[model samples]
Target: LIGARLSGGGGMVSVAAGVERVGVLLEGFEGVEIAAVNGPRSVVVAGEQQALDGLVGVCEGEGVRVRRIPVDYASHTVQVEEIEEELRSALAGITPRAGRVPFYSTVTGAPVDTATLDAGYWYRNLRHTVRFEEATRALAAAGHRVFVEVSSHPVLVPGVEETVEACGVGSSVVTGTLRRHEDGPGRFVEALARLHVRGVGVDWAALLGRGSGWPVDLPTYAFQRRRFWLESGRGAGDPSVLGLAGVDHPLLGARADIPATSGVLFTSRWSLWSQPWLADHSAAGVTLVPGTAFVDLVVRAGDEVGCGLLSELVIEAPLVIPEQGGVQVRVSLSETDDSGQRTVQVHSRAEDAGPGADWSRHVSGRLAPEAAHADFELTQWPPAGAVLVEEAAERAYQDMAETGYGYGPAFRGLSRAWTRGDEVFAELALPEEAGKPDGFGVHPALIDACFHAGVFRSSDAERQLVMPFAWNDVRLFAIGATALRVHLTYQGTDTVALRLADATGAPVASVGSVVARPVGTEQLRSSSDVSGGRMFRVVWDRLSVRSVEVGSGFVRVGSV
Candidate 1:
């Protein structure tokens, strides 16, 4: 029964049944022995293969599949199970000691005490599940980089791959099948060397036995070649004839059959036409249409000067003449042979070409062809008188009230003041409903609204305006119940300081800060892309007051 077969290296040993019966016959009816307890559900029985085969045949006749295990021992069975109590009593008599390397219990998926690796654990393991998968997963989870399955044949490697993938463990599983190939020993050695080079360091000799011999190393070589060739020839007709087949060739005729003028006529219908040059050629002079000729002339002249220099001169509204009806005319210079500098002029003539008794005429300043376009604001007469301050104030109040913010004429009684020189002063009766107090106190929102209204009224008076900058160090005191007054002062356009006070001149809350130049709608919407150095739009929603912090920037609330 002892024989070796050369397959894919590695070894497999099986123990048949009837090992107990053979032991009794060979030793004159003696009892059997269990050599190893591998797991709770299975045992290793040590005996002759012939006796093991006999036991397996008897179990098969009894309708039970007796699997001959790949091992050389008869382990724990009913024969050993009879002495389990005695084994336990013997194990209890010994005191166990700790060891360096960990000992794993095949019954439980955990490390066990080395001293407790005795008959009690062994007997209990014979009836428990072999938690091989659990042990492997736990080992891999603990950062084991490599796993070597030491066995005969290439069976366990596939199982290891499946188990590792199922557990989501990251490890390279390898197998060493030692004695199944004529060159299996050499291949195993080579695999070990490769694993060591990859930082795995596997023990090949210890797992597969050192008696396996090595074989000669073979060298392999391979070669390949690629080649290409080309030939040329001439044909008798014009190469243009090849185009008749609807194929393109580099040697085709250069000249087209149609005349150049006819071809141009065919293409010109679909191409962009130069309207300026076409109009000049058709009319033989400048046209009298403003948009078609005048604007184009202005644009062309501006290009000669510079692009941005004339951008401001293009008017969005139609031009109006003072005394006469509006006439849209495009004027251009006539072609002449003179090399001297010439001026093209556009002026107004108030008289007809015929004889006139009295003619009032005005000639525009002559300009070079390059500086042709100019902006002019024409007026008929001067204003008779200026508007009163009260009227201007009424207009501003009405505008704000209509646009919302709860402003009205009743709110106008809050305050009124004016400055003569380097001073600014204002005093007015606070509305009774505005809740004025004997001492100073003001609501933040009311203070902001009043400042807005005052700025509008004052801008009309002194022609100087105040814009929003930042609010800082704002504190409320002595809440107003009747009315509140405000006092504001500025140092040039850079800094502005303002205070909310009562009619008795007691201070309430103040903002002492600097002001930046007013920003228009366009600048507020635009931002610079730092990486690309380009301008882009910054879209935003409603903004409100959050908190007044002691900082240099305005505080506005919004959701992004």
Candidate 2:
């Protein structure tokens, strides 16, 4: 119910009414009030959800351009009376004290001593109308000419300006800490400049980190620009002649245009010398890319086509990195259809392999527009109805270690787990040492933690071990979460769908389904084998040393 907007009814729709008129018009409605008076004509009405809905219809019928504001609670109305006791109880431990600066009370529409802000007063403040206009006017009358809105956006500055004008304080100045959708530091500097020009004393020395109390010349403008006042003989470069397009992706190199379709391919080569992390993620002394890397590649390709929803990517073959050379990688995306969905595939081969060499298809999937957000509320830290999986919290890693998944410190991010029936809730995070990788939606280590949580075997399970073989319908909402709260629902004996959110429970990404297959240590070891490079010494019998000629002038004669 947060961020719901309300409207005012029971009066002439567009007859130009203020708070007083709107307040009188809403005499019969319960849990309703004029929340704030932004200006002479801009008034906001707050009320309960049901009452607000009904009022919106009435206002619309009378031709009022009624719209709801984005606010979570019905504050400054009778609806807040329900939380009066709770708020009082929450504030009961706090003791009020006097402060040096004067405290203005919007609840009482005047200035008040800080000593009066007790539990009861706090409760009343929530259950009463917000007299923002009154507070602004009172401040202007009390010789407070500067009104600084300490918010990221200037939501209340216009109201303050109107209040000052209504109070006949024409010389009052109104400003804000920062503007919405603007550079935060730049806006703060602008705000400071406005305050300084208005004769407000600022501690420049403290802000600049100069402690010795010595005067120094400060630049009026922070950035120095080259002056172009003089005419130059050099001709300007053509703006149309741009350089080659480059992509700074770790796995993907420069962007390439696909020849036959409206799609793109990101190609690059990876080796131990280039990406040492591949070495860290090896099994049985053989380097192989993790399954999560394929997911990342497919997800990146989807992003290029504006279809980041990875529908299905079956890991056909393992892409093993060689000891001496690298594997040429290609993440290709197909042109999108009418529904904005496209096909994505990951293929790789030996870097020095010719066109005749077959490329191993590592993963193939469908990419579409982002799916609907996962339907799981994470506001409550750990959701109710799920009990902690003690075994998983204690022994999941050990169980995985037994199956050749020797997780290093970076990959072991599984922290907590809870289960209810077929659903599992787990909290995972990369250790501080692991940190986060640049240019990835979610790190492979963090994603692997999700699979680690899936190691939990319920009473119905027959197989003791399983690994993620395929992923379907994956959608990323927010990227690069070092910490996540995952909600996994088992779809079958070997498959599960998961919804992941940030530490605070905001949705990060959702996987429609992840299919796991029974895996053995032998299988993992076989897949991680390094194949191509020569490692053996051949003996050519006695003929190997007899043909050794030291000098270039010694040409081959008859038979040696």
Candidate 3:
């Protein structure tokens, strides 16, 4: 596998050309052939090292945006023909039997007879081009609704989904078992969770052994939704200073320069009403800031300096929005170190707190100078073979809401979107009616909308409510963007690295990596104590329990 990534099986070339165009290009290549017909413009070429290299050069020289797919062995071409007889000999003794489930053949693009599963059939299966699209079409035509790829890594999920879409299978869902480079057991459980959320019944007892303990009945805790915002003591600075320049971010009040200090401080305030969207996100019924909002603050801070990338950020506390008032927000960026890195921290206190009150640190991170961006030369507008995501803007929030992300008007900013293979291109904007505070580097509403655009690339299983777990190498270019054009490329199973640009396509911000994960109510609850020492506990012994068996001469008893 390492060889496949770095060298070995050589590279696979993806050319955005029609079949005839690709056939003309491969006329002189001896070891190359069309591996698959993915979409109208998606043509893949597999071959030995020299032939693959020549094909890539030819495609690029002709102004085609060719992508090199990593793989070690050249399968489905003449090179694999050399192992055919050996494979047949090695499998000659195997006898095939019919199974409970119908086995569809990717080689034949249809269901195969058990008698045809002979040595020669296996040999040809290995030597032939994988007819994944045809097989998918066959399944769709046969009314299959769910397609699950049982592989450690979901290498064919995108293809399968694309084929299903092309085959006009509207109700179909495509999912996988695990992801590459992830914890096997954890990923397996996650896969099962995905299935469960999609309404797939799983035999939990069989999978986890029947001896497992039964569920314990317990009393549930009721969370207090008391207000926590301070009404006064915002800062030491003159209140009139806010009249100068300002930003539209709730976490940031106004930009102020530290007179003696080398860096700048941004002051802001947050309440449930600061942005109506805050109320839409609650963990265990308590309204706290989502981690993705913090990413907005960090990236905005990174943009203040030349550093656009948030190299690292650790969220320590749940910044709960109080019921009556709100919290005062301050984002501080220290002087740049010798390595051109700066310390960034987010601190907040109740608005009613005294001037001498200590501010609690919520998030801290390091901001580094902009690194090289993985630019896709998107200058070509949607690329040659990209597919436009129809009605993406209309369905973006609806689909996300179905998975527990109930975005409000402020958070529903996806304007339009498109998808090209694994990459998603989208345009997001902060609505003027959102009425955000002014002077934000990049308002959370707008940035959050940028993340929301990811819905365009989501499968049903991926539609769950996910939040940014960690951010790395985030860089900002242009600051205070109300509208943005975003390019999101998949980095892993649950991670996407993004590049941000203004409406005119000017670079705004780029992220090296941002990992996201599905979040549940339990995981989102605030651990901080703001209930004023009021706590509740239930004593199970206080409750009554009675059980009795009844027979011809026995007594029966039951209690509620």
Top of the candidates by lDDT: 3
Please name the candidate that would achieve the greatest TM-score relative to the true structure.
2
Evaluated at residue 390, the lDDT of candidate 3 is: 68
**Predicted candidate 2 versus true structure: per-residue lDDT over 348-467, tens digit per residue:** 876656557767787887887875566665656456556656656458777656555566666778888877788887889876445556777888778877877777744423535455
List, residue by residue over 1-560, the lDDT tens digit for candidate 1. 11221122212122222334323323421223343322222233434456555554543344222344554433333333445666577556666678897665556767778777665676566434345545666666766657676665554454455556666665464555453543777767755775777777566557644432422234565546463422112233553575322112111112232233211000000000211212111011111112112222332332222321211121222122212112212222222124322222222221121233222211111122222221211120011121112333355545544433234322444344433343333434444333332322332224433343344433433432223433332333335424445445666644455555554456544444424233232322221111111233222244565645334433334432
Each candidate: what lDDT? 0.36, 0.69, 0.70
Residue 9 lDDT, candidate 1, scale 0-100: 22
Instruction: Between candidates 2 and 3, name the one with more favorable TM-score.
Output: 2
Give me the runs in candidate 2 sitting further than 4 Å from their true place.
Answer: 1-244, 280-286, 337-339, 354-356, 370-374, 391-394, 433-435, 458-465, 520-526, 529-560
In model 1, which regions exceed 4 Å deviation? 1-80, 83-96, 151-155, 181-188, 202-560
TM-score of 2: 0.50
Q: lDDT per residue, candidate 3, 284-365, as tens digits?
A: 4666777768887777666656676678887766687766556778898998788888888899887656557778898888
